[model samples]
Target chain A: MSESRLNVLKTYKLFVGGKFPRSESGRVYEVSDAKGNWLANAPLASRKDARDAVVAARKAFGGWSGATAYNRGQVLYRVAEMLEGRREQFVREVADAEGLSKSKAAAVVDSGIDRWVWYAGWTDKIGQIAGAANPVAGPYFNLSTTEPTGVVTVLAPQDSSFLGLISVLAPVIATGNTAVVVTSYEAPLPALSLAEVLATSDVPGGVVNVLSGKASEIAPHLAAHADVNAIDLTGADADLARELEVAAAENLKRVLRPAVTAEDWTAEPGTERLLAFLETKTVWHPIGV
Target chain B: MPQSIPQTVPAHGPDAAARLASMADVTASDAALRRFLHGLPGVDAVGLEGRAAMLGTRSIKTTAKAYAIDLAISMIDLTTLEGADTPGKVRALCAKGVSPDPTDRTTPRVAAICVYPDMVETAKAALAGSGVHVASVATAFPAGRAALPVKLADTADAVAAGADEIDMVIDRGAFLAGRYLSVFEEIKAVKQACAREDGSAAHLKVIFENGELSTYDNIRRASWLAMLAGADFIKTSTGKVAVNATPPGTLLMLEAVRDFRAATGVQVGVKPAGGIRTSKDAIKYLVMVNETLGEEWLTPEWFRFGASSLLNDLLMQRQKLSTGRYSGPDYVTVD
Candidate 1:
């Protein structure tokens, strides 16, 4: 029986609108370990797939952004809890994808879980830190508060796939901004597995869509998408980043350029990522009734 | 034995026979209705979905898209159905229906303003001379579990209150239990109740609540049943279910309407209510209508979208088309 049994390999597919779907283009690329042994075939998402993700993210934005800060915080913390339960699975996948030692991969997976918790706490308090009341000389009371900048397109960091992907993803969604994330090209299994965690973590469908494909092929379409309000170029090469930034200007999309190719993923992410995808909305009301 | 004979409908136009054959003997008895509906046709889920997916790829851009956008706006039955609906809210909705895009006066008024039964008078008062009809959802609405007398009274109240169109839900319990004649008789009763004492009757749109029906074949049967029982329009869902109007479901209804026209020479409209919130989704429905039912159903008189938030999205898209810039929610009224 053991000799006759076959291994049931997992099929990696695109996560869009909170469901797993084979790429619309019906294309897949071989995802292998650092030693060049095939692990699985990741869906080669097309421009149409990217556009569909934008539509999903946009659809999810209203409900997510309108959710109470307390609710959003609880959902984000739940993601951390779910990630902790699957620590061993991610650690092994990370080790195989990045050719890291078991212990090192375990450390990376732990940090990813910790990062989620870190961003989770920010969900409730980010508004307080970002909003302000201005003293106007006139009889009008003015206040400025932060609002999510609609749908955002993110490029996950290439190296340290698990920790880096979480580092970029948790912040954008922490502030109620829906994200369409492009997973690491070389190491997509961990990201695809992460989508499963998100689905069960009380996160609404389409709030965090993950596509596994070449960032070079998918980023341009997202950047030029009129519906996409912002783009993160952390994983793109210099040429790709420059081209994407130009395309993003078509709809005046807020572009988050990478400061360095290999920033420390385990380092503390301040308000930079959170602030990048938030719009400051100011309201004025008359003081006298 | 008399029940075995096929029922014939008077030919109001030249092509009436084509429509009656499928509906013929359908209302004769339990067995005949079952056989007629079962024998109508079997829906290939994969093929039906494949066709819908293929039609979704047609790109209507530039002038054609602008034309479709306006035409779609006119076909909207701007709806607001909540447990907390108030007269104030109904008036506000009716006002929005009349002037969808306040920034541009050229925006066409919607086809109708849909509300609950009690708000029919309020909606009629607000939309008195706007040329926009007032549609009321009756027949115990959302769920049709009420007694037949109560359901008929509900329809009568809305019609008496000056509702121009009546949207009624069919009992899915009877439908699922294979009590096809009961469902058929219920629709006919409601159709009679829509008649006012003043020699005028409200147009009747039968709601299938297709989510509860849960199958393409059921949707097709429900469509034919409603049409044969005298439905002015066949609607997809009540917008209260987890799965409301979907592309494949709407496509199936469009096909039924098309076939109904080909068979009986009687033209019926199709409305896919619920969960349609974007201009793109609305345009896709329009495309389905244009492709399935052709140019005849393209007019507001033939097609209607039972949606609420879809109106604002259409307005925003219209603004983008004209101003060449994306408009935010702040620029539009929140109803």
Candidate 2:
């Protein structure tokens, strides 16, 4: 009998500039399962890669933000639809990355899809809830509205690789912000695969760039990037977060602090993530022509 | 392969212009222009883009960044080329060009103010003593499809209206159909049209409309053709096409100027007009210019950005660098 061929494992690459490219640094680190079994090699993104991601995100910000809320909502919904179609692949990847049972992994994947849908629905409505007109004393009309805070750098939650990543990322883009996400260090395969879904979806290129590397190695460069408008520190540890916060202060970046503890990935998430990357603009126009 | 750069070529001399006009044997006939251009090297798109991407990573920092920012601001050809551009709008743009940041008079003025032929007089009047030149786009502009006489008239009108520089677009149809000499002669005619009776001429910028040509080889050939026809500068686009100036496209043009200088002893400026809208993007172009052609091409006379929104972003970033705080669009005027 002929010998059977070995399965071809895929190499997880970084997503930037709307294309999938291996890290410019040409370095890849071994990614394994929770049980220490080999999975694949993930691209070890460098500071240059972080800078490139910021460029991509900044380029994408104009089109994504200028897109009507309805259009953005449909694009987000398209992401959820694409994710639903690739359900089994994510289930397998998540199960391997986190050492969860197949059923639990499937549940995590389902929650991620549902979380996209939830954010997708909020795209058109977030503005109405957050924007308002005020009664000013002078002969002037004053109104306030929320605008995307340009490019946002997101450090995905290190533990709940899939669900937590979508939780932090979906809200940023749904509200018209483009993100450069640093995927989980230990469990990066799922986040990498999610990048595939994002590409297939209607989401514009550079709207959500995924980098698979150590957050410690990549997050600091992004935190200090003058082009990056804000950063979410959900995936960082105390010391790294503290360092990033200090660097973020250099540009007055709107930082979302890390949660106190790793929360249940399936638990309810509020509007705080959506509000995290939004900048409010109040306009005053004269009442008379 | 692109030609290797030589160590030094004497600066383009008076006779070099006569020699440059003589270097092309095929100038008199259509087939010769075709043969010469077709014989030129082909560009590997992937390789060209890779070089541009690599050069874009130079980390221009702190003091270097501040210097680059100011240098970039001074290099801007503050442009407003819309069908809806009125006298008031042109005047406003001219004012902004003279004093980029009203709050800070110390800010360096822009290199020039770019406008249409009809608005050239207004821009020139507004920028009379400011040392800011008025650059007018002619030669049927966005689309170089009009008859030669009309295109020449457009050039003469702008030059007569006190325009110091005339930006013209080449006919892409003639270029794409491989009629290289026709394209060359048209640029020559426009160059002649830019000359005034007083023996001085407005500097000529030839726009290749790189997006329309759709190939790097064509852009390279067009660049040489324009240079041989006595173009003072070669621009990448008119800012009207869907794919205006890009890093790779501009890099290719920069390489052409570098090589043209090596071959003919003539130096031509490069303007990557359109879609470059931030302080960072401007710096990257500067990086490309610095690394590809070196610091000799870093001055406003040698390099220019044909953009409008780019000025505000540069000003805002300049404010941030100076005051240590980010300035919003509110702080800058909305010209």
TM-score of chain A of each: 0.97, 0.97
Candidate of highest TM-score:
2
DockQ of 1: 0.08
Residues B1-335 of candidate 2 have per-residue lDDT tens digits of: 23674433322223445557657675668887778778888988999999999888888889999999999999999999998999999999999999999888879999999999999989989998999999999988889889999999999999999999999999999889887888889988998898889887788999998889888998999988888888888999988879999999999999988888877677888999999999889999999999889999999988999999999999988887787544556568887
At residue A91, give the lDDT of candidate 1. 92
Query: Which stretch of 10 consecutive residues in model 1 chain A shows the poorest summed lDDT?
Result: A259-268
Provide the TM-score for each candidate, comma-separated.
0.68, 0.72
Model 2 per-residue lDDT tens digits across residues A103-206: 99999999899998999999999988888898999998898999999999999999988999999999999999999999999999989899999998888999
Worst 10 residues of 2 chain A by lDDT: A1-10
**Per-residue lDDT of model 1, residues A1-289, tens digit only:** 9999999999988999999999999999999999999999999999879878887888899999999989999999998899889989999999999999999999999988998899999998988889988999989989999999988999998886899999899899999999999999999999999999999889999999999999999888788767788999999988999998998897788999987646988788788998899999999999986
Among the numbered candidates, top DockQ falls to 1
